[model samples]
Target: MATSESANSVSQVPENCRAPNNPILKLAFKILCIIAVSRESLDHWKDTKNKDWKEHVSIMVNRFQNTNVTAGLVLATTTLFLSSPPPVEHLMAYNSTISYIIAMISFDAALLSVISGSAVLVIYETSTAHKDMETLKHMPRYQVIALLLWLAWPSICLSVATCFLFVAIFIACFGSDNIVVNIITILACVAFLSNGALTLYVFAVVGKKPANGKKNTPTQVIDMHHASIGAACLPR
Candidate 1:
């Protein structure tokens, strides 16, 4: 009776715990196990890649924090300039109103861009904080759009703000009664133009380098997995 009960209990064990009897079933189970193991390995690889991507994004966040601080200063300066305009009678008549209007519009646009970019970046960072694997793999349409706006919009708007600010300053200063200030402003403008020209020349010269004089085919799409290799090749 004991032997029979023990045998019956063994036969009643769960199908998953028991080895398969048929050769085909055994082969199928082996394949499933292999697939499961491969999937786990692939997930491990993806996790490593995700960590690297996060590090890159963290660096970006730090740089953007500095940019945002600079933009904040610009906003403050713009606000002060807008609020403390010269008295109506004292205002210069050389298209001063038009320049002020341009500066005001540019400043407002820049503020809006900065706010929107920050909000989008926050949302993107929050949503991907836990799981960026899917984001990296699928690259959803909305994510792409958000990423583009976050990366480009604020900087472009800030550039416009600075340009308009300088333009307004130049117009106002040129109309001023102080000869020394006018001469200094003129020299500053010349320096600015020369620096911009030199920057462009340097960029043009530096962009022509190839690997050991063998022209590398420009890759259309950059793979995050290969980003480390490319970074390693960069000058320290």
Candidate 2:
């Protein structure tokens, strides 16, 4: 007991004798942590060979969050107003049911986008990843478009649509209303086809990597700041 008291007093005394606090020191500590994290991330990119692949996925995680926010605010407003359908066939099986199911599917997509983006963005934003990309003029717009097209593709998800519930919703809404279903289906098909074609064009344009060490002029897509950090931290 005596030895323990002596040791505690000696060890604890140093802490008790320190100055009240220093704001500058606290800020410096915070900055140091940031720098260390940045350094780690920078090294990570340098080691990878598939720089474009990395960039592609990074942007993907990004768009998810962005589109999610937009969808939430815009679609939610639309849905609220849509509660009062036109005077004719309000709650009946045709238009109302079909439209409702489609609305639900759209809502579900927004949610999934948010979840996917938030999960990755959290890693990119909170961690040292930001440390590396402090400066970059532009990102390859073509690649970004390609990525968006890929993400939009339903084939990758394997099933007819995204998850099972999405498929069910699609089926529920698809055949209910002759006019509404036909119009919506045509619009959706056109959109999918157009976007897919655009993606293919981008790929053809960016057919091969530049032979020499050259990066094309970046066309800013999302946050230039975040993209810059990702680019910088990209390992050699």
Candidate 3:
């Protein structure tokens, strides 16, 4: 519990939920995923181990099967195209197409993960704080802010990637083999680089557990918690 509006003391917690070092880290990490890789797959991976996954076995099973099946299709199609040798087969020999498909599908899963993960984290916090829904809702609005960020950030990133891909596609359409349909290729690289950097920044700030419950001093910790769920932490 908050001991007072003091700096040295620590805030109280319930018995569950893992804490990170800096509260702001989660927010940064969330954004990084959007820019870095298939946000959907990452989120799906996390969802695989969550409570709902266990409770809703049929839904979870179907989702997993479908995802793998889609991935398999890309692989099978590529193999078929590559086994023969010819003018058409030369394009098939380049495996980047399959890689690109995988990346695109993965992005779908990643988006879902970003949304679900943020929700889970905020709900967990409310539970840990032992506050009711209304009380928790007013506390820091973690879920609300996360939802907003989830909407906007992807649009910005997608716009950049899509615009670039469009240019590349137009060039390829003109019979310039060099352009190619490599949307996934470009996206995969961008996602990995941008998100990886974001993850590192978050780790540096939060380290392991979130800051010792900053229930005092302008409520920095609480705001940080909002930031953790994928919102901007600073006023900027």
Candidate 4:
């Protein structure tokens, strides 16, 4: 009777309860799964950010190259014109107001083109992988590139403005009688003004972060609070 009662009691026990899984092992496995998932997510996020960084750097490099080319062309053309003088009868009076204005335009345009080309070359050199990695050790590479690009924009705009001014000066001095020249001069003036405005806007707006009415992130707030407490505890 005792053997039968023991067999009945054993049978009454739930299958799950009879051989339950180890709670500690189950918990450890769950934790490991969470960690693995977290790690994969972090890796994916890093890859995405790196891709974006590379794309941005490529765009900045292309823009710098284009600017440098434009500046070089302008500089070359100006140099050629200065090297070859026309017959005295065909040339405007060297001492005349128009001549002086032309001289000023040429000087300014050449100077701006040289400066812009040099700056763009420097930026390109600095943005190379080795240099960028070195710079990244101190600060984010993207921020460094962003700042350099911001500086380059003004130079680019100035170079363009110089080109427009060169055309306008030419039209004013030599093409005054032609209606087409008058229209072109007006267009050049408009382009110059637009370039100046864009430069100003870039300086004022592009790098600035938007001020959304939001509080600091939890991590930042906690860090700040801890810093404040630590400061308070320090001996004055």
Candidate 5:
């Protein structure tokens, strides 16, 4: 009976009186609440960023697959041509051996870079896919930058290989005495250079990402809506 009475007394305590009367206790409680809320917010932000990152990675994977296929084709063609024995006259021609060597080396390097980069990307994605976002959040800034640059290596290497291949072809053509080959090579080089310039402009200007990397977040959108409503309410 005494225990029952005590329980009843505790349950019947006034709501206002239930709270700690000590100022320090109240302040500490408030601080703890703030900390809990901040932690939740940080986790939520990380989750959102994780989703965005995964989406970006998926896009990169698709591009890498395409590049792999294209590189494989180029590599195969170069390997087949290089495997065959060249005629003695052609082998002895000025710059012919050097040009062939450069072309072979460049194509091999390009293929290797693409394959290695893609493998690293796949391994990273597989490892991180099931992991907590906290791990990624704590990753060093320089490491993240390095990973981004590594993702870009395949494209850069491929571009350099292609340019070298073209250089090799130009060298071979110019060394020949045939006027037809010379004229055709010159025209092709002009077109290739123009296309390269256009590609640079497109990549540098049109395809540039935003500096701040801020997308249309919910708070920003809500603020914009409120501002528009406020402007509408004001005198014209």
Candidate 6:
């Protein structure tokens, strides 16, 4: 009798744990289960990779973290400088239209750099907080953030060039023909051209993959049991 009662209790456990009959809730539960299982599988694979290639993995992770922090600081400084309001005399030197346009472009570029820098910092912090296995699960998202951050630098450069263009126009229009002003205008033009060229170079080179000498891919572990359980729990 006791054995039968224990068996009945065990049978009811699955029923108790089952999702509601509502289709939406069932679907949501299934999705959540799949995601959880997927994360587990990824974590297991990460662990395996760390075990098999600890030194290489550590070097790569450290490189990424250092790069992120360095890039974030540079971008944050640039953003702060660009976002600050110019002096009254500087603003008065340019026409209203040119001033407004430069201001808007600078603001937009600054905002983008801030966001990019913030994302990189966040990814670096999060990666550092997690253990090796846990960090691997987030690498894809971090890569995407890094790509956006790289693009933001070029955008900032372009904006800087635009600001310099307006400065050149301002110097050309109302300024005296003094040698000092002429030299400044020439420098501004050179800066604009340099920035434009650098922007083009960045866009061209950003897509190339680093020449990491390793040919062996990391071994991945798939949790078939967890996947099967998740599939079984899903609604027909």
**Candidate 2 vs 3: which has more TM-score:** 2
TM-score of each: 0.58, 0.35, 0.26, 0.41, 0.58, 0.34
> In lDDT terms, which candidate is top?
5
| TM-score of model number 3 | 0.26
lDDT per residue as tens, model 6, 110-187:
455456545544654464446454443345544533433453343344445445445535543335445566576678
Q: Would you give me the overall lDDT of model 5?
A: 0.60
Alpha-carbon lDDT, every model: 0.58, 0.44, 0.41, 0.51, 0.60, 0.47
lDDT of 3 by residue, 1-236 (tens): 33373222123221111123565765555554443232411222223344653454344334334433443444343344334333453333232454344434334444444444444444444543464323322324354445435434433433333433333333233332434534554665677579869977886675344476433555776777777876555555
The lDDT of model 6 is 0.47
Ranking by TM-score: 1, 5, 4, 2, 6, 3
Off by over 4 Å in 3: 1-16, 19-24, 28-55, 86-236
lDDT tens digits, residue span 1-236, model 2: 85797565444423322212577754543333222222111222222335753664465455545654654554464344345544334222323555566555555554554554455456545533544431111224344233323444322222211333333334444554567765775676677668879976875576466676455556543467678889999999
Poorest lDDT segment (10 consecutive residues) of candidate 4: 36-45
Preferred candidate (TM-score higher): 1 or 5: 1
Best-performing candidate as measured by TM-score: 1
Clashes of each: 0, 8, 21, 0, 0, 0
lDDT of 2 at 142: 43
lDDT of 4 at 232: 98
Instruction: Tell me the spans in candidate 5 whose CA falls farther than 4 Å from its real position.
Output: 1-52, 85-95, 204-236
Mark the regions of model 1 whose C-alpha exceeds 4 Å error after superposition: 1-51, 86-95, 140-146, 207-236
Report the alpha-carbon TM-score of model 2 versus the true structure: 0.35
The CA root-mean-square deviation of candidate 2, after full C-alpha superposition on the true structure, stands at 21.5
Error of 2 at 6 (Å): 64
